[model samples]
Target: MVSKILIFMLWFLVWLLLSWPPRISSFITGALVSAFVSFMTMDILVKDRPSGRSPLRYLWFVYYIIIFLWECLKANIDVAWRVLHPKLPIRPATIKIRTDLKSDIGLTFLANSITLTPGTTTIDVDKQNGYIYIHVLFLKEGCPDHDMRLPVVSKFERILKKVFE
Candidate 1:
C-alpha cells in the first residue's frame, strides 16, 4: 500500500516537473491524470520491489551513476579517437557473462547498461540461464573478456541489487 502511494506521488512529481502550467487548471489536471495513471499501473508495471533501502543507499546509487557516466564519457572519447585515427584500431568480439541476479528486472538493467556504454552492446539475454551476450567494439586478439567479479559487475546491476535484492 505504501509503495502504491509512493508510486503515485513520484509520478505526479515527475509530471509536474516536466510540464509547465500556464494556468492552475492545467497544473491540477496534469497532476490528477498522473496520479490516476500511476495508481492504475503500479500493480501491473512494477516488476521488482527492492527491500530495506536506507536513504544512504539511494545516495550511493546516485554516486555510482555519476561515476558510471564519467567512465562512459571517457570510453566515448577513446572509441571516437580510435575511429578517427588512420590506423583504424578495431577488434570486434562477443562476450558471454553469467549474472547472479535472478530477476528479470536485474537482467534487463544489465543488458541495457551494456548497450548504453560506448563500446559495448547487449546482443541477447538468456534470462532463464542467467547469461548475457554482449558485442564489444574493440576486443584485442578476438577475445572478449571482462572481469565480472565485484566493481566490474555492470554498474546498473549494483543499483538493481540495492533496489531489488
Candidate 2:
C-alpha cells in the first residue's frame, strides 16, 4: 500500500512540474491523468519485500541521490571540455568491474549512473558472473587496481547500496 502511494506521489509531482501553475484546467487534467496512470501501473506492479529497516532509510537515499547529481554535473563539464579540445585527451578501454549489490534495482541504478556520467558507458552486465563491462574514456595504466587497490564497485554503487539496499 505504501509503495503504491509513493508511486502515485512521484508521478503527481512530476506531472505538476511539467505543467506549471496559472493554468487551472491543465493542472486538473494532468492530476486526473496521472492518478489514473498511477492506479493502473500500481495494480500491475508488485512491490518488493521491505528491507526490514527503519523508514528513515529513505532520507539517506535522498541524500545519496543529491550528492550523485553534483558528481554527474561535474563529470559532464569535464567530458565536454575534453571533447572540444583539439588534443582529445582520452584513452578508451574496457574494464571488468565487480559490485557487491545483489538486487536488480541496485544493479540497474549503478548501470544507469555509469551511462549518465560523461565519457563512460556500461556495455553489459553479467548477472551470473557478477561483473559489468564498462568502457572508460580516460583509462590510465592499470586503473585504480594498483594504486588504491580498492574494489571496482564504482562511485555510484556506493550510493546505491545506501539508497535501494
Lowest-sum lDDT 10-residue window in model 2: 146-155
Q: What lDDT does candidate 1 reach at residue 125?
A: 78
Best by lDDT: 2
What is candidate 2's lDDT per residue for 1-68, written digit by digit as tens? 77787888788888888877738887788779888989889866646665676677688778867866
**RMSD vs true structure, all candidates:** 3.0, 3.1
lDDT of 1 by residue, 75-163 (tens): 78978898899989888777787777787755776666677666788888787877877787876552433553223445567666765
After superposition, the stretches of candidate 1 with alpha carbons farther than 4 Å from their true spots are: 21-23, 47-50, 53-55, 141-151, 154-160
Candidate 2: count of backbone clashes, pairs at least 3 residues apart or interchain: 0
Residue 9 of model 2, lDDT score: 79
Error of 2 at 31 (Å): 4.9
Local distance difference test, candidate 2: 0.76
Model 2 lDDT, residue 158, Cα: 72
Clash counts for all predictions: 1, 0
TM-score, model 2 to reference:
0.79
